[model samples]
Target: MINPLGRLLDENNYIVSDGAMATELEKRGVDTNSALWSAEALIKNPEAVIAVHRSYFEAGAAIATTDSYQATPQAFVEAGFTKAQGAQFITQSVQLAQAARDEYLANLPREERLAKGGALLIAGSVGPYGAYLADGSEYRGDYTLTDAQYRDFHRERMQLLADAGVDLFAFETMPNAAEVKALCGLLTDEFPGMTAWLSFSVGASSTALCDGTPLDAVATMANDCDQITAVGINCTAEENVTATLHTLTPLTAKPIIVYPNNGDIYNPIDKSWQANPNARSFAALAPEWRAAGASIIGGCCRSTPADIAGMATALAAQN
Candidate 1:
């Protein structure tokens, strides 16, 4: 049987996943400054949320990652919601993405899907524990949780989304090796019946994680975890992706998925992004990243639908 991620790659020369979620929402006039980020949109403007997913699919993203990146119950309760409410909100992310996919397909002609391998997929996003701190640590890899602590923090949400029926889980934007090891265990034992992918974030260099763990060493760490359907990078600089891929592609047989942030730089102290004026060039660079061995390609922070649409056009033209 084709592995889930393998099926996605087999269906096309390269699978184009959706672009930025939180930043895209901001462009549509949603204020994403709070700790909740895009998860805030789940409660305030769900149609706005569905619209983002639909826009990605219309622009040719075959995989629509859910807006649950920062939807942990612990964070929700910290923001004053009850445990049950947080769980419901987390589950809603899956439902909204599924609804968007159905709505998009209903208006499409059968031929486009017949040409591709299938309709769009929904990857339930699971952000790192640092995301819950809202201290900008997710990018810096400053987490200090134990293995059991990390697994406890993620298990409930993983179970919630898996039971909610997302096609796959995206353990996206992880920073440390310890958390990756713990998450791989959660996938194997806690959610043994589920499927997911693990992705790490890095700094300017490709040789090590943001926290200085050697990049390929982490991939080697999970070489035996069959449940991790794929492994790669996300929320990383566009410049660093290919170099990191060069380091990672040899460590594991799993497909390499790279969805980099626009060239803009995030300054944690200022809580501002020094915008990349050259982001328009991202589309032109997509092909090179694919050639570098990124089987799953997409955009990350600071990427808009227009950016993804342009990326879609570029990638399809190359094919």
Candidate 2:
């Protein structure tokens, strides 16, 4: 299959990715209080998942990231689901995104569809093992696993995503270098036809990953991998994004993709998000991130379709 993302980047300097999935679902009245998070919608309210994806598309996003970030087989098993049921839910995540993309494009005017690149891509969200822990380990990167073990944990979900027909993978919020290396190996060796963009979750310092590995080192590691189509940061603070992009641009020629949180700090203990007074709007920050070398920009946690609309407008002004 042709790489639609690469082609879109070739035609346009920037692409707008979708905003937060779970938070958007919450706005639609889905309960995400459990560890399953947005994946819970797959079983109880699948239409709501489609609505969130369509909302991003209507907000000017060209990529619809699937709601499979925390929908791993292990997570389902822990929730008392059979392994087969876990796989079904994972596949349903992609199907839901596809439904939204197809429905949105079909109803759009021909001129508008052409203006938006004529095609919307689905990125299967492959969040880190830390996300499955649901204890904020994704931000801490406190866990360790052998490369083989890491591969075992990720393989089933990735295969499900691929078989379900995602255009690419979004390895977002990755914090561990060992796990990333394992993923790269898995892609090259097992899924050579597939491609993905690896985005990291960094600490406040912004120069290193949450695992304490230097950003340049891990960025270089991912850049060296042929299957990694883009490299940058996501689910990080807005303040750290520009500096992190500056850190990454000089290291790799690959496209830089960034989708930061809406500047709300997460309290892992109580599982709540508190407002950050300093958080700036995406309308004001999107241009700066583009200037800093981000080719793809959007929001992460706490970011809504309104925020993505701001980014789309801000980025359009660049031309």
Query: RMSD to the native, candidate 2?
Result: 1.3
Clashing pairs in 1: none
Per-residue lDDT of model 2, residues 199-256, tens digit only: 9989897788899998888877798888899898998889889888888889898999
The predictions' CA RMSDs to the true structure, in order, are 1.7, 1.3
Off by over 4 Å in 2: 114-118
Cand. 1 Cα-lDDT:
0.85
Question: Which residue pairs does candidate 2 place in steric collision?
Answer: none
lDDT of 2: 0.91
Q: What's the C-alpha lDDT at position 231 in model 2?
A: 90
The superposed Cα distance between candidate 1 and the true structure at residue 66, in angstroms, equals 0.9
Tens digits of per-residue lDDT, candidate 1, 227-277, equal 777889999888888788888888888888888888898886656899777
